[model samples]
Target: MKALLILAAIAIAIPSFSQTLESKQINYLVKFKSTRDLQTAMKKSVMSGTKANADQKVEVITEQMVLVSGKNAASAPLLKNQNIEYVQPDYELGLIETFKADGQDQKAQVMDYLMKNPQLMAKAKGDNPLIPQSPNSGAARDPLINKQWGMLDMGATQMWPVAKNNKTIVVAVIDSGVDYTHPDLVPNMWRNPGETGKDAQGRDKATNKIDDDGNGYVDDVVGYDFAGNDSLPYDKSVAAWQLLLGGGNPGHGTHCAGNIAARGNNGLGISGVAPNAQIMALRFISEKGTGVTSAAIKAIRYAVDNGAKVLNNSWGSMGEDASEPTENKALRDAIQYAESKGVLFIVAAGNGFQGKGYDNDTAARPAYPASYPYSNIISVAAIDTKNQLGKFSNYGVKTVHIGAPGVKIYSTVVGGKYSDQPIPFLAVWEGTSMAAPHVAGAAALYWAQYPDKTMAEVKAAILNSAAPISSLKGKVSSGGKLNLVNLMKY
Candidate 1:
């Protein structure tokens, strides 16, 4: 009878182990109103002495206030006492280990814990919208003469004349979705081999289907959309700015994309700095120009995981709220990861018209991610045709790294369109946002020439090649605008 009991116990244990093996780890994104609130919660959790067993490990990463742990029955009491806002489980892309707790019942427990903590939930709810409704309204088409002159006379000097163009290098443009069907861009767009679909003729097709490649994204033929979380075709909406202060503008991203790699010398309206390099569009910012730090982090990670050698971020914010610790750490970690993966990151120094003295005033301040420390991140400012800094461009000798042509510049637009307008072309759309891409494109040219150069070398080539601008002396680090003509010599 004793032997029979032992055999029954062993049989029950086997099934439990199988269930646990298939169980998935749960990730919880917790938000607090302020650092004070976040610290309070952490203190409470620690004082409560709610500890996990040897089989479970609870890691609360402060950067994003994320708590990751293996699924278990004990998570409920600890979460309940800590006042968590939302407990979204199994929302991550990949599969992980499971626990022996009741799956359905455990999910309910987690949800209930969140519901009981209304204050935490309210605080966690992000106010930053995915799209902005009333963005900076301006004329779309700039004059043709102005566009033409700016393209030819001002900094029209070619930078990649003698260097061997590196076709193997890939750049990831993380912004509003790219029109892959655009004639100038179709040939240069990146495609995922593992997730491509096929037609009846057995030819590869970009389709909208879920899990076709078992990568968790449905019909992400070109790239995955974190905003929508599904394969509905991404298009810019006018109302995207309400979520993020300066978001909800796809025009900015479209123009930047064209500058980097828009199929040069193909009878197109304008040519890119590196015509042969490939462009990968990663849409982290929605059509309405607004995005949170979390979404940006995910996009950075995605670009690094895939085959992006360079990453461009041309957006930022200015204010007291911009210096949140959680968001800062996330940006730092992401950039560090990119550096480790041998990828280069370029960001804008903001276009808020503020000087270096205005940063700590607590009024409208300079933007972040640009301010973060990562050797690979190059902060850029804007310069006009006269080789003088744009009035509205932000500058800091300690922070702003370099300057590039931004005023009256023309490049690619959405919907397979080209800006045919002339120099000083499209009236007055000038900002550091526009200038950052020039540096990014130049980086591509540098990468193509010295494929073996470390990130530091490529950075030096860009700074060392800048043309001296007397007007910008003492305002910018290199004290000049980028000179493509001089860069090719290296």
Candidate 2:
């Protein structure tokens, strides 16, 4: 059963459309007063040629919210009905930063760099490329930990002892699917409990093709793929041809997942801030790194309904459009749902246009979800190892909450690989997208240490513990960069 919203409560102020729906067909998200009202609204649609026509095009995401693929001709009339609260286009959103430019491919640059530097590749493949970690230091022994300047700068070294052996918390990477099999991430991947054991018929629940957990999904051992609408949410990395034609993912979600909770001190790769946290992989963005609004909402709801305590939303619209507020209303509602469930939503402040930074405080249209006025939201900005805000990072003293290591970030990628900075086109990897998971992992780390804290309390501690930094001053709400040691102390 889907959750029912109170009649008196509208998800948010539904902004009126500037013009009538265009005649062309497109996907539109509609919010009806009730499930029963769906039929009544169709009856009232002037373009509803037939009941079957209406039924064929509608995809119900929730009892009240639906994704309709048809012209505004049918939906334009829906607004007249007092029961129909909101209707708007289902906008297509993509990665916060573009990876290709001027015939240069970011992935190509990475491959070229590796090809020219076989020695580095050889070292990458070595079982133990560096000196082993001293046991009493309480630091990770991962071969690449030294390259993780961001983690070290955030005080990961000092906090590791306290975070190690703590309760494992689940943090959902709500983006492209994760490479759950990555050597660095496999040990900390989330395994669905209900789908682990044998079924009533003595069949293995994980492979029995049954909804063993009774959670509307079948054998979701880790997480579901909302984009592909199937079970396996693996990160299908882009091929050479796909990149040439300008499409396919760059292991964005996998990198984010590694930052949140790659296994620590495992002697394989780097350690995340919360090495013990479990990464719940939820794929909403397609392989091309773009996703529709409905899919994003479903991913958020799924993360909350499951056991995820933190949601790392590293993708969003390039910028806010006041006229299209209704288009993203469903997004707000979904996030509100997470908030009601005591889940913290850590969002990227967004990389500005052309991969250059911008000030959200005075921009005509600021990045959203990050700019959204939600209590549970902790909008993050990107900063380099020097504690300087990334030139490509967006900032807002009031909107963006805090700063975190995002520039030249080193973490896990697809194909069981690790890179300090893979996509090299105009510093594509240096984005607030990378910054958010730092906070997400930190949230998990802090929560693990103090399980009694509420969502608001954890958020407060994280923000309050930010170390006042000159670069981030007057730019983010916290006026500082995240300090994990200070946060753990709090």
Candidate 3:
């Protein structure tokens, strides 16, 4: 057994604000009554003495929404324009796991407990090896498969043979980015059809620096990185200290992608719930674990416009802000657009900031995107191996829909590594951030089997197929936990 020591409690300041807004220059997202109304709103701003200058940058996020960045972009005249529906600040967003202090504290507590109980840590490490399993086990051969209690509890392995034969479904991982080079994830990545062949000059279209598909992005072979402003959306790793400071990328997107779709039955690493699905890497969050609403909107639209059938949104805001009631409108519209196009947006139900799960229905403010009341949204909460809700998870009878395995979820990370435990401790790699992907992967698996079903039908199938769990009763609307075998049968 490894020797370990518990540390004394240390004081840490928890930020009250759920989402962050830019501080340098005021950036406003203006949604017009129509696409043509942008010119009129801009003119109204300048004529009304908003001090328009060349320093200002105008980016068209959608046909009706434009991001205006300038010193006085928030002038009343621009917002009150008859042609404009509403104007709100563009918030700097982070991964849902990084915003909560209790979520991080949970990691510290677990580490301390592991230190005090070295035997448990030693057992966990010894039981979960990174080598292939004995063929006589009659299960997945991935060496570390035993540690993925989540997959075992959900019956993901049982549906593997059926899922393997179905057509691939594209799910957009709209978070940090994906390590597409990871051997387990590489086989299931979505490659752009337009960027794969040779260009006009016989140069490789992927590296030719040309927008071959003319989808407005240049050389988006796999997926585009709005955060890094590049074609390759690779999940970048961060320093341990940076994660401890609560402002760094912890290979978040890669982990989520692996949970949704790591290749199966190849005798390599772990398999995702929907091993046949393809991941469309869309990076909107920066390495600092922060991104803006504009980038998020772009990624959503891109996913919908492309062939993506489902979007795994594992990041979202906590509470409501009185000052920015309208801040959610932009995201709401983007999600609504996805719904209109028959796409499912799976989201995390969010974690508590005070060290335990909270009821979102009665809270002063519930989580957004999850609680957006959208028809296409499936809000997921986290459950442990014992079928008990995680202390750091959030739940709501009407808001949160179902529970999935979130504790100690083992999957892919950056640099071809796989772990449920991360250094500097981030939710112990737990939280709804880990839970939502299970549902997303389930959605993909079900959709691949029922390709002709509508998004609403898919949502219904998943909810109706849940396996009732006593602990989840009255907490999630489904009153049960995610059952992949049942979902596949549907």
Candidate 4:
């Protein structure tokens, strides 16, 4: 047993202290050189369809940019077309929706143990009525509350006194989509404050086919869908990923959102870490669990342009699948954009490079968005109930900032459309995906406590407030997992 433990310690090597096109889009992002009028040039030379088989429709993502479709070999001449600066294939990005936050069996056993021990359950609830009662209690109004072990692990119960009233603080859940209809989640979904009974001329801003907020989107009362190019960012239903009764639920965004801000004290489903914080649903990933970087970029812009001060990214690339991590310019630029706007991006460290774990501190091995060097970003790794690093979580002592409870986390699964039988509890879901929101929720609370601080200050406070753990000393930069109790006191 001693030898096995030694080998396991050796393998972890913690010292590292570390697409866009749209759904099924075969596209490339091209920028114009020194172009003043990008749209005019694109219309005249490319999208006009008058330029020898240029019938392809182009989506102008920004000022001088275009996510052009209808080409694989067709972009070669266009790159040389005097007006074009450069172009590259719109790479397809996938979500890390699966990982080893410990197996569901382990989680089940833990729950059984807790169930047998009422002492632990009572201790988990402590004195936070803002946090609902645990499951299995005749008195537990919300049966799913006890199932939410992740909240207890991160000290969310302790943070509630400071955050239960700040409904104006918004965190962008940039993934598939959130089930806004979920009773536990609806009250906390971010509503466009600009949405009123009527515009100056009496036209309904929520329904009028006009850009009421002048944010370039029409009738986007909740959030925008970059994947389908629609106004509603609600998680669209999928037969395979639905959270059917007695079925394995897979609504990625909804699950993440629930972890961040599902309403507490409602005696309904599980409680969220930041129940008072609002969620701005941004659907960039498709129902199929894949999407292009362009859509993600657009979603980031939308979130920042809106009132989302903290961005919770539960999905990322498989860095181990390639020779090294791929640096995406459009996506990097989007992160920079958010940083410039005082928006803090909380991202997951990643599941693995490609099923092969590695140290993130080494430049040769890294994760996108999370590993990207930025002050506004807070990279997160997954830890189990034991406070030990998860076997499947990627860590970098210098890169991955902190750790959080992720194994078999229970939260709100998609109810309407996204689910078949409406499983109120998304039990046993795992990954760094579940961990990022724990930090996001805390960040929202911290921002509320210090609404005057800049995004950088909030990021630093969260990182500096982590409770260092011996097991994770060399695994994560903070050498600790999230401790909301410490965060609030700090």
Candidate 5:
């Protein structure tokens, strides 16, 4: 027995020695003129070290290659032999991975090495696509004002009375991008104090340039255009009639953004739940209202990293098939990371409400991020004015945590662009997608009120304060619809 125990300890000790001898983040970045060159260089790096046991991994990210060593050793010789243009240590982004010495660090190191050895820093910068300039006028407000007054008249008025106006808390809209230059939106836009752009002097003035912020985006002066994968401004567009056959063209995201926090009371079309909160639009979905798991993950990470305390994800699928555990796992990890950073994620339950035509014994339909056990995510369902569940809204006593108004809702629209005119506001879109933003906007209001509340507490306030609705009783977990007035007490 003693001999066996000693052997076990030795086995463990071997891996420990390998781990300790190498630095925590001894990662490398090797650059090639093209992906083909990168592949060749990677093969050479691996082959050069027989018994060296180097591990190479492709970056899920674009524009780079990463190679990690199972055992630490200098990579200079291998890189030089491969005719690689550059090699460097990978720098990490966000506080979470800065010590990993991975991807970004390697890029920086390669750039630095080239500058010192080959004067490569003088190369021309990449051309950034032009972002569409937003108009100066506010969106029309008649519809939003009506919604605001209707909510207020219906006893849903818990918003900060006008006295608490200039709090300027940041609300990150993790959906399609926003029209930042919109006249009304400009006043409430969140400007990064740490961010600088060029001035009229042209003497290296601190301006919001594409490269100036150094946050992996150029001149993200308004917000990022992640779908385009660049800072260039683009509007979300629905595919032609031949494509979707039913859904409207791309403006869902803009409409949702306006619902949450379009400039309110500026004599514009409609008022957002929290008019004072600064909206930081983070576009993840394409104009078609569809997005991949990877883009969703990045958008969530970007929002949390850039000071967005509340994240609004009004899109989600009705859970994965039993065979797709891998996709579920990735989503679970990403959500856990977001919660760890103290960001609240609000997701929409799918719209599949034609009662399954069977008994409830079957497993309740599940929604991806919402159904995931992350403490910050709050899944929402849609309800109509009659306090009845919408025909298309998904519901599960065990899965859906709350309900909100999603029927025929009015909000902002994109491409309402006009000369010296505010964007047009639209009314009467119906979907669970519309309902999710109401909850998200309320979350912003709650977070603004209790800035220090944990994601759990904020979620609790939302669930606990909802107004009971008979129509949704057995279908919804809480048997209630959202009630901002009741939540304010907390």
Candidate 6:
């Protein structure tokens, strides 16, 4: 009967979720009206006679959310604070890594190096020219590019020649920290014009003790790491192999960033979907692949305030499907704030095997934030090389917006830098997390070509251009998969 009710609510897209959800863990998101009100609220909110951590204090995470730690389910002290709007559990968000890293299989350092050089590549190929040699393998110059079927699936190469505008467009990879030093990724990172050299007060810009731009964070040159309350947002902590099934990876963010903007035509490594687009690394998740909901919200505001127009969120909360979609107001406020600021959010539809098996209609058993209603949000399902839905992907005819290639995708990892400073380590990854970025790259491509278009306009262009395939017919809202070639023609 409960299942029937949930399914019925999904069919109508009517939100029926009741109850303020929170984990048993000692953390919660408290929202106050203004920053000035935080001090008094903290005093009233801290529980007495508790064993919470002293380091856990009220950290003002965003304009609408605050991270309050050290409280048990025994008492809801945050709710007692004056001007406190709402407090919900700081839920755990998991990174969707469908496949573990197998490391790169290189052809040979000498041949690989020679093939990357346009001048040497022709001769290096000897008798064979560097063309789309065969359909079975898209191998061109970079050995791994051919293995990245997602690139070919979306027709990403067609825009490489003309999309110069992508460099100016910033797509924030809001997940684990990015490896800014990665060779294929280094050239394309977003430089902070506000925090580059010297502050208005004459402090050394890069290492100044002050918040150079008065943006709250001190010396956020690349991006801020809210999880650690620091500036470096590189993915650092990776759990072991058996732990991979649980969540967390050292190179997850780096992989996702590469999906959005790894360099193209460099003759090294795989090319990004929107190869020229700029990446703004926003690290809120930990090396352990877990983070509080408040941290994720802060990352979104940071991305929007820092001039990132498109945000790729390859993460989602761990929860089961209910009669109605779960709602997180504080998180929703942050997402809506970004959308209001003209940021397009490309989110991964949940992995089907999480707490809830959402392989069917995700709308009926919705995933938070993705299932959360917002026009600026583009919830993506995952598909394989054959254009079939991935076995692990979640879909919703009304909730998940579109499908994109997510299986066995080859992209950059942390162990290496660029070709010049090459300590290269690449891998073939999978997940709806991988799939969302493809749509993000597609959106970036469209946004780059028409820089002046509205987010709604860009969203429409992407959905309109999708190739309606039978495989995706009943599985997704679009009943089609993303078509970058068609998006470019639009």
TM-score of every candidate: 0.65, 0.84, 0.84, 0.79, 0.66, 0.77
Two-way TM-score contest, 2 vs 5, winner: 2
Quote the RMSD, in angstroms, for model 1: 16.9
Model 3, 251: alpha-carbon shift in Å?
Answer: 0.7
- Candidate 6 lDDT by residue in tens digits, 1-490: 0111111111221122111322334466667767667665654445453323454455667655566665343134444455756555565565655323223433344345444643422210011111111112232455467767788777776666776645778999998888876667777778777777777778767677677688988877778788788877766744233222223454678888887888777666878888778888888877766665678878898899988989999887434324334355666788889878878999988776532337444344456556767889999988887888887778878778899988777778765532211112333466788889899888887888888999999998988888998888877877899888788888
Assess the local accuracy of residue 217 in candidate 3 as a C-alpha lDDT between 0 and 100.
94
* Clashing residue pair totals per candidate (backbone < 3 A): 35, 0, 1, 16, 23, 6
Between candidates 4 and 6, the TM-score winner: 4
Better of 1 and 5 by TM-score: 5
What is the C-alpha lDDT profile of model 3 across 323-398, one tens digit per residue?
Answer: 4433367777899999999999999888876557788788765676678788899999999989999988899999
Q: Which stretches of candidate 6 lie over 4 Å from their true place?
A: 1-25, 33-56, 71-78, 98-143, 199-204, 239-247, 318-326, 354-364, 417-428
Q: Which 10 consecutive residues of model 1 have the lowest summed lDDT?
A: 1-10
Give the C-alpha lDDT of model 5.
Answer: 0.55
lDDT by residue for model 2 (305-420), tens: 88899999998755544444333677788888898999999999988877688887788667877787889999999999778899888999989999999988889987688876
Off by over 4 Å in 5: 1-144, 147-165, 197-210, 232-234, 239-249, 322-327, 353-365, 417-428
In the range 59-155, model 4's lDDT, one tens digit per residue, is 7776666676674323323333455554544556667754212467856755565456544332111110121112221222455766777787777
Candidate 6, residue 122: Cα displacement in angstroms equals: 37
CA-lDDT, candidates in order: 0.56, 0.76, 0.77, 0.68, 0.55, 0.68
lDDT of 1: 0.56
Sorted on TM-score, highest at the top, how do the candidates line up?
2, 3, 4, 6, 5, 1
Q: Which pairs clash in model 2?
A: none
